[model samples]
Target chain A: MDKMVYNFSAGPAMLPVEVMQQAQAEFRDFNGLGVSVMELSHRGADYMAVAAQAEQDLRDLLQVPDNYKVLFLQGGGRGQFAAVALNLMGKNAKADYIVTGQWSQSAVAEAEKVGQVRVLDGFETTGNGPRALADRWDLDPTAAYVHYCPNETVEGIEYHFVPDTGEVPLIADMSSTILSRPIDVSKFGLIYAGAQKNIGPSGLAVVIVREDLLQQACPHTPAIMDYAAMAKADSMLNTPPTYAWYLAGLVFKWLKREGGLEAMGERNKAKAELLYNYVDASDFYSNNVHPQARSWMNIPFQLKDDALNDAFLKEAKAEGLLALKGHRIVGGMRASLYNAMPIEGVQALVAFMDRFAKQHG
Target chain B: MDKMVYNFSAGPAMLPVEVMQQAQAEFRDFNGLGVSVMELSHRGADYMAVAAQAEQDLRDLLQVPDNYKVLFLQGGGRGQFAAVALNLMGKNAKADYIVTGQWSQSAVAEAEKVGQVRVLDGFETTGNGPRALADRWDLDPTAAYVHYCPNETVEGIEYHFVPDTGEVPLIADMSSTILSRPIDVSKFGLIYAGAQKNIGPSGLAVVIVREDLLQQACPHTPAIMDYAAMAKADSMLNTPPTYAWYLAGLVFKWLKREGGLEAMGERNKAKAELLYNYVDASDFYSNNVHPQARSWMNIPFQLKDDALNDAFLKEAKAEGLLALKGHRIVGGMRASLYNAMPIEGVQALVAFMDRFAKQHG
Candidate 1:
């Protein structure tokens, strides 16, 4: 038996062991300062360097362009839902939304209070497997921007391609998909991600916004949501989640240590395939996500017999697999194979799933 | 000499050594769970249990009543500046503010955007000091509530008196004062504190709102900021800052273990008095705040000879008294005395200050 259980629960999912250890070593007193990193002022030279380094590391990882402002703002992706509307929805504005699942739908609902938000497309399947049936969007010519959650935690849906927006701004909520793979930075006007999953922790949301879109924020937007204010203050308009920012920088460093996003992406693909391919070969266990649109980060599946679901879960737990229970919104089993979950973990999961399937069948 | 220097940055301030060590030990895999708390889903049983326990511990510490909802919201004290106005400034509403320093003045600015706001009084003596001028007040009888910042971080000001307003609700931005001492929770209708100083981290802001005030949020308020929605969700309607929440819970446990607010309050008072008294007795150093209204959390003092400021700072840094520089708005030195700062730190600072004063005087 392993020293600890294999965690399959999606974000605040897992981080590299080395990052945690370094953070711990610095916990009591940073660089002999005798105070934890949490004790430093957000605006102090010590903490500011941490923030700048984090932004730099992220830019290096994603190859984020110079024109875009990378902001480590507070509130989660939930905070961004309203902030997006309040910031982007301005005079004579109607934004387009792709309702992939719960998160995108929530975004649409929040956007409704600020402007005329029209949904163009979304995922229809319940979990992990997404059938993007966006009945060809009729985008408003004068719309402020287009919005979509690139990955939905609840339904486990993912976008395989960046939606083409022509000259219009393309905004993607890459809360889960960020750092899991690489994407073209020039294709989108803005990209925002909550840090809990792929970055470092919750509380911190990373927004990469093109300079041109900075002035379009709605007048009623709070100063924190005002990109101009955050940019001007260097994301220190208020005391930011300083500790989270530092931890994220550490995670970025870890990513760099592991050979950046491209290498991490390949590792993730391999892990996802190991589980999905195994699930497909056995009828005793079933995965419903369409093969073409399957998410490489989260894999949700179920036992053929619902009656054995409890036994499967219990045995999985006994074997040290944790948080495999699917989201209550969609009941079954979900194995979120984020970057931290090695291929070895996937192999272990695959082995266990097959064994359980044979016993149930 | 001590192993580490004393840190006195107000918010995003110092945390206990043990908590950081625990975080470090479990950074990569909490309890051998093979995942950092940062990556764990807020809804996962592990993180959920953490969220619940953190809240429970907080509630227990504050002795929060059943009717008072404790919410972990984002943005910083600055986010609350806007949110408080939008939530409490209901139909035909006007709010009154007592401007003490930078934070309160900012709150008034935010409140003005929502409705008619009155600056009831200012305790400032020509824009700098640590006391509220109690004599000047024009509090409006028709105002829905009276708002004040109990502790101003930059100016080192604190309110010694709670104003009587017949039936008007008192709202306080206790960002710096919270957990530093015990207070009567029933006296204020709403109290919000940022988690940087004296608490845990920078991302999570703890809001203790009375039930009656929860339902008064404006029509245009976002769901995440809507107090009623947040209270109903138990601070989890959206994905929370999971690792921060877990760390905060650990801090709460630490607070209880170190002995409740009373013990904490005595230690805090002693620490503040030690530094302040040393500064007062020195001809070379002086604190501008009114003696009675001085904040027990933040002590700002200036050297009599401005020419020696840089040398003093350099020498102090060499001696391991870090972050003693005052804010840019007010030049000199400011020492934030939070719960985690031991008396030994204060004693060390005073001893250094006295020796420096004797040599430099």
Candidate 2:
């Protein structure tokens, strides 16, 4: 009997309905403990178990190698932008950043504060359409790491293949695209993502780093931000965002029940294809990114006439489709189809778009 | 009805039952928006209203001066430890740290990473039975600032009056004692608290800094940690811990309903007096801290027989008085009576302690 709605906000995006239901069901009393999970001490057994199981579930889902240390930390992707530089560039003092879009460019700004940063263009665009990801980059072989963003939420660009960094450690900010399918944990020196998108909520960031890379953190690094220190403390170096971590655990369980990353990958591909295909077929709407570079997580499309932007959003809200307004930088519309966004939502979005186009044609 | 439980956690502690209930009731569909508050975009109108209202309510409760900028940020007290040093000691590169206990000592380590730190003994204990707070300290007037922890959670020491630092800016880590009572906000240059105790949850730290103190951040300071940058962006430089922030707003509203901090101060004083009075009267239990220095927030006591510690905790848990175990450094029992802890909880704890002492006497 509840009104049906599908949210399409880019980050701090939607999570599975089932996870939300279960969280509500036990919001006050967790595990019959007579307190909200958020109220429990992180050092206590009940909370430790919750923390450990969430890590285990994430490890199983990612099939992470034994040599990597998984840390759940506070501060979002921007925090890790500084943390990565502070943690890894201590000895070498330099790294290469492949600038893809807004997120990756922002990461460069943070890294520049810590050490030497070489910025390389991540993609080439013809006009304002058909942006092709640059497979080859002029990387510094002796750099501490090669950092890049796999999916750019603002520009709706993504890499279909991971870049090969050879001897240099490859680091990825997968904030928008992580857990969408699968990743090779051994391929990168580290992978960090803000948990707002596919994982759980904002305020928590998950970092998976090779144990060997953990030794060279800057002496001045805050113990909380020092990867080595946090790894040693098992990410309890400080009281973590406990509620967000709990919610992430619920999401991980939902992922497993829905057949893990493999099934999620298939569903996500189908959903992205549904929206992209409809956009390609329409004269009234179009997505600018190249087919190969178009993101499966965020699809940004523009209306033929920008004047109808408000009307489109208003009508969409009336029908219970939400957050379709595009980023100010790219003015039009964006429908973020993360792992939690079911195919039906995308179908509904496409149906709305068709009707909107017909009404304004 | 759910079982009654009073969680005595140090941080990531208890919140008002009404706030928790409201949060749970709206967990799935916040404000009938058909999406969890966590799922809403921080940049959106709905979440912005929530964020703004929280800050306004906090300002109203504290009577914060117009010159102070309040920031809700990620990472806990420890994160702010580094942030305070990085933000304040940029030009001067030195500060006096009055060491009170574990939390203050930890802050010194982080500050030492940034600049020269003078560690002044905060209190003197005579034979571990009575500790007296140092009324005056050998301070550096030319230093960037004077830093101290108002209430030490682990050692159960608290300052009844603020330390005078003349022209030097005074910063208080009020993580344990903030919002339990009324204080003159204008007396200190800056005040910060990890939200778990008196605010909301673990992920957020609330910082109230004088406008003049916001400048002079180290260039290398991560934007996420940079006070000026965070203030300029309204703590939205990145997606904030939206859910925790919302819950904190709910808590501020609850405080208003409960007659604000003045009423809270009276209630807390009564609660602390009841437990401390009972301990003072009992030969089987004793608290070593000087009455003048004893913490109203954290009260640590010792059993006459150390072997009965486990039994005490087990029995207390059964009676729903949870997390009474003391810190490892201070081996005894600690009961954190934060703002959310009602007088009834303290009464229950005292009655249980009396019965336990008689049984083991």
Candidate 3:
């Protein structure tokens, strides 16, 4: 029998086991149609039902307002960095970006290509060694939008509270934190998440945008990237990533069956806390981010001795804990406890770390 | 026993039975790692092998020259419409588009937004009702590139020969017809195909661009859409459609096992001939495409009586022949014989068409 395995990749991360099983079972024959759901045309009734249900389920899970448009688009979070700028910066041609970490910093680079961008620091070094989220930023009342990364996947930094940008539309790149918990959908003007993490799979991004913000896209914006055009067509402006969208629907159904985002939020919190608690208690393993700012989804922890990093990863892989290596820029280990990751996986990682620590210590 | 099923959806269409079965068997535990391939990180060695192998196999299949870069990207064929214009128009800021059908016309619209566009009619009305491919176009030598859709999926039109554009790069959107037959890769400056039809799933697009054409992308082009940036990163500028890319790799392997594009071309020709010959022999059903310009991939046929359309579709579905309805713009039925479609399926379709005609006649 195969041993239990846990994947801890930051994005293109794990999906619910139930969702994966259902998708596998129906990989070839969907709804007794004897054809793979992926084989169905996007415009056809069969695939359309799947697409609409996925969107509706996502809406229900998030409690999205009727005035908002949930777009299942191609390109990941990076694509949205440019798309957001092109779509919203047409009239105003300027925005304020909160530079939190690698992701928000990348957003600024893309936004600068289109129009004026003012970068605001998202964090400040506390009196202690760890960094904390900045509570306030200089206001840009006339800006088109205030874009920020609610959860930075690379650095494992996240904001617990939504930054208020009164009168200015607040946009969050929720690629890592989305669906891990419920948020007040009406609070933000737009929220975009790459489907690799807390959603379904790669090749699909979910954009929840207020209806009023859909207009004023630059004329030169690619139709595929134009939010207004995509919103009007219900995100089928072109052939969407159909199979990913279908798999996303299965994931949504699974989420609904597991008592929606409320249940998922509670479960995700418990999972994140299990690892963070273990790391805090152990001198052998340490997470550098401030307790309040540490990500609930991606938890980056380092061993006390950097020399043992290779051995730790090797030993962990032998025990079926995969993809624990952190981003090269911040080397150590990252255990991404996305919505799909059960607490058991975190427990296993903690157990492995304890075993490794004692042998090395 | 379950009846045999044949799917004829134009895109997100039928995949090889062998590939689908293999993928299904291993969907949950890729490479015996006990995790789906979709869950694998693009940066990881496992998935990078998969990505690289797919590109290599595609290169091998096409005999692509060393001077070109093969990029697996997001945003489908329509995304490429904008990408092509944005990438190529930076230097010259103008291009000639040979408008063949709906697809090429749509390309013109996207290109017009990016730069100056000249639409050259791709077809001339023949003495008969059918349209023939125009031999000569008012060429623009100073233009950066000349773009055309080799196969129009909606209208079932195809170019039998490559157009000569002296000193200017020629770009072809082979979304519907790519990998169905072999072609000279060296002839064109760039060739892109949306994966839904002849490749794998919907989200991925395969772009083969000459290295020389990569550098001229507009300053504001999204990094995800910029060929030079994507090429440099090996199409990993951001999280790619990992699962779709894996599936495409499986497809490439399957194509190689099936004796590459040479074998696929012969089989496709036979499949096209079978359907076209059957339609030509029948008075009750007719194909409007000129013989010389008929698409080898998508064949649109009309019944003598439009009243029988719904009945025909219903009856076809009952027999496990699915998605035969044509694009709304072109009424009737479209049978897309992509590479994954076997000769037996075409034979089954012809047999069904014969049975439907006699009963309705």
Clashes of each: 15, 0, 0
Task: Give DockQ for candidates 1 onward, in order.
Answer: 0.63, 0.83, 0.82
Model 1, residue B11: distance off in Å is 2.6
lDDT of 2 by residue, A93-127 (tens): 99999988999999999999889999988865454
Estimate, for each residue in B1-361, the C-alpha lDDT of model 1 and write its tens digit: 2756666676677777777777767766666566667766777677778888888998888888888889988887889888898899877779888887899998887777678887866676454333335544667777888899988888888876676666888999988888877788889889998888877888888899999987788877877778889889888888777767788888999999989898998998888888887887778999988776688988888999878888888888888887888887988988888888889888888888888888888
Question: What is the full ranking by lDDT, best candidate first?
Answer: 2, 3, 1
Candidate 3 off by > 4 Å: A128-136, B125-133
Query: Cα RMSD to native, each candidate?
Result: 2.6, 1.7, 1.6
* Candidate 3 clash pair list: none
TM-score of chain A of each: 0.95, 0.97, 0.97
| Highest-scoring model, lDDT | 2
lDDT of 2 at A86: 95
Tens-digit lDDT string for candidate 1 (A1-361): 2465577867667666677778877777677666777777777788778889999999999999889888999887878888888877767768998887788998888889888888876665544333345435666768888898887877666778787777778888988899987888879888888887788767889998889887877777777777878888898888888888898999999999999889998998889888878888888878776665678887888888778878988899888787788887778889888777777778888889888877778
Q: In candidate 3, what are the lDDT values of residues A103-161, reduced to their tens digit?
A: 99999999999999999888542443223334446768999999999888888988888
The digit string of per-residue lDDT tens for model 2 on B190-279 reads 999999999999999999999999879988998889999999999999999999999999999999999999999999999999999999
Off by over 4 Å in 2: A127-136, B127-135
